[model samples]
Target: MIGATGFIGLNVVDALQARGVSVRATWRKKSITVFAQKRNPEWCLAELDDTVALEEAMRGCDVVFFAGGHYPRYSLDRRASIERGRADVRAVCTAAMHADVPRVVYTSSIGTLDGSVAGPVNADDRTVDPPRESVYRATKWAMEEEVDFALARGLDVVTVLPGACLGPWDVRLGTTGVLVALLNGALPWWVDGIVNVADVRDVAAVHVAAAEVAPRGARYAFGGVTTTMRALFEDLARRWGVRFPPEELDVAAAYIRADVEEAAAAPRRGRVPMPRELVDLVAWGRRVDSSRAALELGVVARDRETTLEDARQWLERMGHVPRRAEATAVRSRNSAESTRGASAHAGSRKR
Candidate 1:
């Protein structure tokens, strides 16, 4: 596995290990602590774009899983980082093929898949026609094409596209990690988006199964249940014994427009305001179907409630709630400021 130290990658390593499969997972220098000191200690240090190290990692392996990618959730140095993401995909797939790995499974995003239509989105549903919401989609799409290039070269390859994966073990993930941020009050308000989530474990299971069952050049959708922003927050609040208001927060359009304007206005690597595209993504979260994974790969998605409960418990264990205290301080300050303003208005009226 290329990204064995990340949230999804670590979960995958554990799931694969539980199935009695020996894994040699790779990570960068910073993530070494998470895996090197662990009980198994089969973690190797390597960068994704490092062809020599990557080839060494894949040598003699029966299957290669490319699960490494950057999250484009914020305003990044789009011109540089986006190209780097696309290039990494190409390099990894090309290296895997050169290493003679018999089977390759590439992890992609449902963001590249179309969700404009109402109702459940199946693996067979046509991908979005054009104009993806952000560079993430564009890069994932390009990487999927790279997979196709490998398949054309007579490599056994399949792509697994998962949507907004969430479950336990999001300690280091990008998107699902957002749950920790929200619970810790790093996020003041939940964006307006419905999310189609798959359990991290289930996504890993499907990846392993696809090594054998999924047909060459096929793409499988690997998502489970769908929940609105309010539903997700309330679930977390209940789990944490906190109060969450059920007020409707419809800021999707504003966020989308703001993201565009921010992206347009901000300098590279500077603080870019949250993009509206993400807000819209949260608000219009689409439903995804995993029937193909269930029937073909023998993978079944866990219940949505179970996924959330597991995430809440796992996050608490990881010491992510300290930020919740920070959020409380901010709220108290705002309230005090409001009170002072009210008192000043009353004094002026008496005068």
Candidate 2:
């Protein structure tokens, strides 16, 4: 688990450990890993920007989970973002090749896919080399291209395209920040657009399944539920007893606001009021068909309501969310979730 301290990476670590899979998790020297201290996986120190260190960490591992790809925090500098993302992924792929690793399960975003305005999109909807939209889209596209280069060099790699993932352990409040922002009354206006979502646990399960059974070069989009931004915001506000924003911004206005906020947040390296990626994701998001994962991996998502509740409750417990929501937030953890036997976990995989 390369990004053992991240939102999705931490969930993936827990899921794999629950199945008795040995993970050689890596963390960057500068990353705060207090959360990882509770988890008992073997820790390795490796930096994504350092190819030599990453290669050393990859030594003797059967598979590498390239989960810690170079995803920029803000989308202000397009050319720099694209170059950094490309270079980082190129290093990851090259490290895997140099270490003679057999397989690599890479984590990528659905932004790299060709989103459809007509209907649900799937794996076949490939993004153009230079994405026609925001820096986030272009960076993800460039990173995936490096994986294609590795595949041509005889690397066995399976890429996963996960939609807006939401569940527990969102320490940085990445995707779940939208939920937190809404609950805390930080969101000034809502943007009306498509939002495809999935449980982080389900997404983690598919990563394990892809390594175990998916064909080489296979890509799966893991969003099982689709809803519009307005409907989603309204539902959360109604359920959590919070007031929804009165104003709704058009896509154009949303982008302009996000850019302005991102520019301000760049200097402090702090969280933005409205993330540029969040804007790009919803503006470019498409309802996706994840039937391939269900048919091939036998992974069915739990109810969307249950998934959201788990995330809400966890945030409250961690105090990232205000204590006022606790009355309706906390819930039982023994809810319906997809399961897989540990019979297939072979040699260790380093994330």
Candidate 3:
């Protein structure tokens, strides 16, 4: 399993282990600390561009899970980003092919799918042609093209594209970072948008299932629920006993704010509070149909409420949030305030 130290890859490792499968997990120098523990499976340290080392890592492993990819959160180096993204997948595929790995489950992002159409996007839907300026999307599209080439060369590969995955073991806090910031009151407002939510556990399950049973060269899109950003924030606020901004920011306002933040932080060598890509995503929301994964792979998605509750619990367990008792106290106080405000309004009307 490449990228075994990543947020999704770690969960995939856990899933495979639970099923009693021996996993050959790979990690880079920076991630070795996280995976070098006594309990981890066999480990291999190799850079994404080093095909020789990766080939050594793939030896004797029947199934390879290529969960490796880079998503820069702050850097604006377009050329560097695209090269790194393409190289990561190419290295994995080349090494897998050389090592004669029988099957591979590659993890791709939902960003590669086109969401501009009217209906929920499925695997069959065309992918968006990301503009020249959007390095991340363009890179992913390029990676898919690479996958197609590998398939033509007779590599057994099944691709899995995951939507916004949330749940336990988000050590990097990639997808769920917004929830953390909102709960911490650092980001008080959100842009108007819709997002498809999926549990990381479910995503890992899908990857394992796809590796075992999915047809060669097939792609499966995984999405749990489609909901507005406001609704998601409200749900988090209610469950975490916090307050979110009542008004949602429009696209123009969000873009302007992002620009200002980026410009100001550029001098300090710091990242913008909100990125332009995020604002654009909010303007163009995503809605995908993942029924193929359900019907073919037998992936049963957990309900939104259950997923959120599990996220809250995991956050607390990971020391990202206050204790359960403290959270309950906060909820009680907010409930009392609401009651008092209601009574005061009723008294004013009577008077």
Candidate 4:
């Protein structure tokens, strides 16, 4: 398991162990892998640049999980980000070929896909050009292109595209940061756009299945529940006893703001409520067609409310946010529903 220290990587690790499979997880030099080390008994120090070390680590392994790739903190440097992203995937794919691993499951983003989202989109949606406006999209497109080259050279590899992921063990916050910021009263307002997400557990399940039996050069897109950010934030506010932020920022304005916010947050890696990637995703994100994964990989879509509730409880358990009363939240949500109904009735009577 490569990228065992990351959010998706950790959950994939848990899934691998659950299947009674022995795992040899890799870690970068700077990461504190103690927590991962505790759960994953075997660990190897392998950096992305160290092809020799990666080959040695993959030696005698049945499958390799490539979840560790270049994730840009800001969408500022297009050239650097694209080059680095391609290089990382190239290194991993080349190493897998050298080590003669049977298959590699690479974690990619659903953001790289493009098509008419009037209904749903699949692998047929990929475009010849990256959305030039967002560097995040470009970098992922470049990475996937590298995987295509590797496949042509006879390296066994499958790709899994995951949208926004929310769950526990996201110590670095990742996509879950947007949720944490809202619940902790950091994000005062939000932009109205589509958000496609799934529990990290479900996404990891797809990874395991893909590695075990997926056809070489196959790609599975995993997206569970879709919602508008406004609706999600309203539900969270009502449940958590916080006032709803009614202001919906304009999408174009939001893009500029996030760029500035990321520039400022770069020094501290501080948790800013909005990031460029989040803006880019929601603005351009489309509903995914997961029929292929569902039919072939046993992917199941969980409801949005259930997924969010689990994520919130986990965040509280980890002390990332203060624990709130479930019963109280339920009661408050019920009361709000009653109030809205009554107001609607009153308006009808007046009309």
Query: Number of the top candidate by lDDT?
Result: 4
Error of 4 at 85 (Å): 0.7
TM-score per model over all chains: 0.80, 0.90, 0.87, 0.90
Count of steric clashes across candidates, in order: 9, 2, 0, 0
Model 2: pairs clashing at backbone N, Cα or C within 3 Å: 1-351, 2-351
Give me the displacement of residue 255 in model 3, in angstroms.
3.8
Residue lDDT tens for model 2, 1-351: 788888878888888889888888888877769887688778888888777888888888877887788777798899999998888888888888888988999998888888654678887688556676789988998889999999999999999888888999888878888888887778887688888888999988888888889899999888768888888888998888776976788889988988888788889887864688888988986888888989998887788898889998898888877776343443222121211222223323321
Residue runs of model 2 more than 4 Å from their true location after superposition:
324-351
Residues forming the 10-long window of minimal summed lDDT in candidate 1: 269-278
Q: lDDT by residue for model 3 over 1-351, one digit each (tens)?
A: 887887788889889989999888887877744532544789888888899999999989989998877765543566776778778888888999999999889988776777667888887675545545455566776788788888999899999988878887777666666666666666745687878788999999999999888999889999778888888888877776677865567888876676677567667755443565566555657788899999999997889887787776877877777667886787789789999999999999999
**lDDT score, candidate 1, position 283:** 50
Per-residue lDDT over 1-351 for candidate 4, one digit per residue giving the tens place of the 0 to 100 score: 888988898898898889898889888888768668768448888999999999999999999999999988787789999999999999999999999999989999888998445678775579888778889989999999999999999998899998889986786788888778877667855688887887899899999999877898999988778777877788888766666765678889888888888788888867677788888888885788788889998878777777788888888888877677754676678799999999999999999
The 0-to-1 C-alpha lDDT of every candidate, in the order given, reads: 0.68, 0.83, 0.78, 0.85
The order of the candidates by lDDT, greatest first, is: 4, 2, 3, 1
How well does candidate 1 score on lDDT at residue 295? 87
Worst 10 residues of 3 by lDDT: 31-40
